[model samples]
Target: MILCCGEALIDMIPAKTEDAGTGFVPHSGGSVFNTAIALGRLGTRAGMLTGLSRDLFGRQLDDALKASHVDTRTVVYSDRPATLAFVQLEAGHATYTFYDENSANRMLAPEDVGALPEDVLALYFGGISLCNPPAADTYLELAERHAGRCAIMLDPNIRPSFISDIPAYRARIARMLAVADIVKVSDEDLGWLYPGPEALMEKLAALLKAGPSVAIMTRGGSGATAYLRDGREISVAAEPAQVVDTVGAGDTFNAGVLAKASELGLLTPGGLAEAGEAEISDVLAFGAKVAAVTVSRAGANPPWREELAQERPPA
Candidate 1:
């Protein structure tokens, strides 16, 4: 079992290109939420930890999670309104404008997590959940408590527009990375977080020193690279496809990596830190393939097991 902790919100996206002129549509989204749903859809035993509202949009988000087979038992229901994010496509990449102040997800408390199941193989977290106060603290507490019990994966999903204090944000991200066994960030994120390549490598090495055994840096179409603490690195190119919208692509890729690791029986507490370069390469390749399929289609819809199986040819 894998536990995903963070916000779950409704994405108001462009529906029709002609009617709306901007072509906006609404979809169930949130970085952690998308990862959990993708894991469930891939037939992995996954659960989500976040606050949900009683409103219609929240109901739709809950229904979508259920449809994706995610365990919602750990989700907390609140009277506050659900978080909303407006997603727009710019240069084929999804840019988000979020409105999460006083939202249900932003109101998550430490008590909401309670005691996690011993069977949980890993804990994944990211997004605006780390930006908020009490909730961010709650997640940090949980990560520290379970640091030795299960593998922890963290993705900051850095968006400078939403972050007011860069230093505080960097500190918070650094704190999370200290407890994470695996950290994923985009090349753009690295550039934004640390300006120059030399500075980026220095900072990345500092993060690796914080206990993450593996750090992955994704470079959009250029591909992704993974650095192991043991001094080994490997890179893979992204599969070329007709891009529709890049929304949720990275989140789904994270899911694919975790799913593949789970399939290889490497997501357990002790397995993550010991996973070799070869194993990590396979995981990234699988993730990149899955993400390629997602980007080929419209919206944040990820591929199911059957869909992926059909795409894979027999050896």
Candidate 2:
């Protein structure tokens, strides 16, 4: 089973153009939440481990997860308000302004992680959960404790504006990377976190030394690259599609990687490390295809199993 741990919140996306000056449209989002939902939709046995609010937005989020067949038995609902992110889309990309300080998800503590299922095959984490304090510490602790038992995947969907202390945030992420077996990051994220592309290979090499066996760097429509610790690199180009919006594209990509790995029974702690280049390439291509489909749709909606099965390879 894939256990996704992180924030679960409501995204208040602008329903119309800024020139129209309209109210926001609500959608259930949160990096790990989206990944979990996508994994479930892709026929993986996925479950969520996070804090939710008792508000209407939270209810909607739960209902959406249920609709996607994600297990919510590990979710903790609190009296505190749900976290909110205002999404503004421009040129197919989303700019988020979060209103999450002191929200329910931010208040998650180490105790909450104790409820995680014991038989979990892989634990997925990322996003703003590593930005905060007690919750961040809790996630790190869980990652360390379970690192030997299950494969750990991390997607540090970094947004620098939300991070106040860059050094500290990088330190926390380094710790998480030390335990993660699979680390998926974006080209934009690497530029912000490490600066120039010249330093990328060095930085990724350093990350591989930490623990992760495979590090994936996504370049949006240009496609993605995977660097294996064994000195192998494979690249895949994104499939072409009519653009809709890029919301959840990365999360869906994460889901695709995990789902494909799970389907091939490679989600075990060391299984991914030993996977051949051909195997890795196939999985990465599948993920990129899934992301392409998601960007061709609206909101965080990802392709179901049938949709993926019918997708043609990128030309």
Candidate 3:
């Protein structure tokens, strides 16, 4: 199973009311939540590890996960309110203003996290969870402690504004990159992570040297590339789709990658370390395809199993 560890929150998406006036509609979302939902919809055995409240929004988030077939057994509950991300979409692109102070997600401490079940082969970590202080420290501890137990996938999804301590945040991320087996990053995230005249591939190379066996980099319209620590690289074109707001496109892309990895029996630490170019390339292509489906629709809706062709190879 792929265990996603992070925050679960409500995304107040821009919507049109009956009278045509713009309003915000609550959507069950958060980077990690979206990935878990996408993975479940894609038929992967996925679970979420986060703190949730008993509030209506939290209940909605819980129901959304159960509806998508993601396991919520590992979820920790609190009485605090849910985090709210008010989204702003301009021309099918999305940005966010998050209100997370003292929310359930932000209050997670290392002690609040429980033990993982034995079946979890990979842990997916990233998003704003790494930006929030106590929760950030909690997840970092979990990831660091579990690094030897299973494979790790991380996508910083860097939001500079959310980070209050640049140096500490960098230190945490640097430690995580060293332990992660697979690291997915965006061009913008790379620029923010290692700003300067370093070429894109150079930055990718540095990431590989840091520790991850495979580094995947996505360039919004240009497609994505997978780089191996031993110097192999594979690139895939983004599947075409009618553009809608790109809310969970990247998150679903992550789900697709994990789903394919699980299907291919490459969801293990050893599998990731020994993965070949063709397999990693196929995973990236699958991710791009899934992201296409997401961007073709409004909101963060990922494709169900019926919407896509078979992913598993014939026995």
Candidate 4:
């Protein structure tokens, strides 16, 4: 099973009301939450570990997970209110106004990160959950605890507005990157992490030196490029799709990469470390394809496994 560790929250998206005015409609989402849902829908053995309130929104989130077949046994329950992000879409891109102070996910403690079951093969960490205080430290602790026990993937999914202390967050990211087996970053994230006159490949090389065996850089429409620790760089064109809203595109992409890697038996620490160019290419292609399906839909909804059966390349 692949365990995704991070925030689970409600995304309040704008929609036309019966009265013809725009109103916010609640959707179950968060970076890690979306990835878990996508993985489950893709027929992967996926589980989620995060803080969830017992409120209506939390129950909604629970139902969404179960409906998508994501294991919720590791969720920490609380009476604290669930986090809410009111989304505004402009030209197929999404921006959020978060109301997360004192919310359930924001208050997650290190003790909440319990022991992992033996079935777990890989762990994924990312999102705004990596920005806040106790929760961020808690996730870092989780990664530290299970660093070498299983393959670990990190995608900072950087949101600058949420970061209060840039230097401190940078330091935290550096530490987490050191233990990550796979690290995925966007061009914007790269600019934030290593701002200067340095070239893109140089930044990726520095990222590889930090620790990950594989470093992936995604450019929204242009494409994505993967840099291996052994100095092999593989690039693939972006899968074509009619854009709806780019909310969970990256998260679903991460899930696709993990699911394909798991199917290829390359999700284990040793397997990922020894993966060749062909294995990496296959994994990345699937990720791009899955993400294309995601961006073609409304909100963060990802395709079910059967939805892509016809599109799957022959074994």
Q: TM per model?
A: 0.93, 0.94, 0.97, 0.97
Name the TM-score of candidate 1: 0.93
Candidate 1 lDDT for residue 23: 61
- Write model 1 residue lDDT over 18-111, tens digit each, in one string: 5556665678999999999998988888999899999998898899999999988888898889999998778777888899888888878887
Compose the digit string of candidate 4's lDDT tens values, residues 203-222: 88888899899888889888
lDDT of 2 by residue, 20-134 (tens): 8678988999898999999998888999988888888889888989999999888888877888999988887899998887777888888876656766888999998888777
The runs of at least 3 residues in candidate 3 whose Cα sits more than 4 Å from the true structure, single-residue gaps closed, are 18-20, 310-314
Once fitted onto the true fold, the runs of candidate 2 whose alpha carbons sit more than 4 angstroms away are 17-19, 309-315
List ranges where model 1 is wrong by over 4 Å. Answer: 17-23, 196-200, 310-315
lDDT of each: 0.83, 0.86, 0.90, 0.91
Model 2's alpha-carbon lDDT is 0.86
Model 3 weakest lDDT span, ten residues long = 306-315
* Clashing pairs in model 2, backbone N/Cα/C closer than 3 A: none
